[model samples]
Target: MKTDILKFQNLNPEKETQISNLFKQLGGEKKQIPLKEVLEEGNHITLAYCEHNDQVVGIASMCAYHVISGKKGWIEDVVVDEQFRGQGIGRKLMEKLLEEGKKKKLTEILLFTEAHRIPAIKLYGDLGFKLKESRIYTLKMP
Candidate 1:
């Protein structure tokens, strides 16, 4: 059977609850921030889908930043409904984000995925991302 289509659009601030639900389904640990806070931060972009039944099925968020070398973008959270995983929805979402990054003249884009997520790593590699041979360290501040 043909899968329903996927479309990308800017997140509607009013749909924050739905966005939070999607993130929760994906096992994200971050607290849900208000949409107004996201807009005020001026760095994040959240993309969502409108399924055939007019329901939302996926969400992806990115943040753009300027570094000493040039502009860069980071993919923060990307989740497709569990029922929709095998469809091309995730790929389309990522393509849309990359296109936006390119339009803004970003020099690089980066994201991190757990080592066990081989499919995701393959997808990123197919889209021309390289595996950086370096360690990533993080510290949480209270």
Candidate 2:
């Protein structure tokens, strides 16, 4: 398996379709950030994934920003194709994302996983992430 951070310019219609399908596997439908924005926006955004024989099998994204404290990064949409799970594909994608974050000189990286996603939680722990003692709240705007 090969993993790399994807450049927005490298995305094509086919790749967009493939990645959209991958997000569907993770239960996200029509929720992916536009590939154009991912490419045209500031360098703080990173999109990493694993591919085998040119087919993307896993993906993760990191978005970073600077504040008074320092540069902070957030990981999102981490998912491995259901058929490709348990083979370390997700780990590879995450490692690539982390590498990108470090390259950007982020002071911290954070992520949110469903409480029921025990395996993912363990993976984050093994990767040296500690649970933050704060409540997570979300508001949906229509």
Candidate 3:
């Protein structure tokens, strides 16, 4: 399968629908991202997608920011279609994110993965990500 990494730009409704499905494959709740707003506004959010035969098969996003120390990039929402898994699509998506980080001169990149996602964890390790002994906290706002 031929795969190409695409940086999201000038998105339309059709591509938006495909991205919604891709997120579902990652077990994310189905919701539409405000693509136009995101692209038009400078929020430092970048989305990379893996396309095969003009169809999106995988996606990954990065939120980069300037910190007191320096610039940092956080990877999020990486997922490949079930049928396309193990074909290096996810890896390509991540490579795109890394390339973006490099271009932005990010001081560090970080991501969190579930412990049960063994394959994903292995992939992250191969990409030179090390497990940091840090606690994660979250809260849902009403």
For each candidate in the order shown, give its overall lDDT on alpha carbons.
0.69, 0.86, 0.82
Q: Single out the weakest 10-residue window by summed lDDT for candidate 1.
A: 1-10
lDDT ranking from best candidate downward: 2, 3, 1
lDDT by residue (1-142, candidate 2, tens digit) is 8998888768899888788889888774347677787767666678898888888899898989998999999998899999899999878888888888878889999999988999899899999999999999988889
Give the winner by lDDT: 2 or 3.
2
**Candidate 1 Cα misplacement greater than 4 A, ranges:** 1-14, 44-52
Among these predicted structures, which one has the highest TM-score?
A: 2
Superposition TM-score, candidate 1 onto the true structure: 0.82
Clashing pairs in 2: none
Query: Which ranges in model 3 have alpha carbons more than 4 Å from their true place?
Result: 1-9, 28-32
Query: Higher-TM-score candidate among 2 and 3?
Result: 2
lDDT winner: 2
* Predicted structure 2, TM vs. truth: 0.93
Candidate 1 residue lDDT tens string, 39-84? 5535355443435355556767667888898998888677777877
TM-score of each: 0.82, 0.93, 0.89
lDDT of 3 by residue, 24-130 (tens): 87774535566665555567888888777777888888899998988999998899999889999888888888998999999999999999999999999999999
Each model's total of backbone clashes: 0, 0, 0
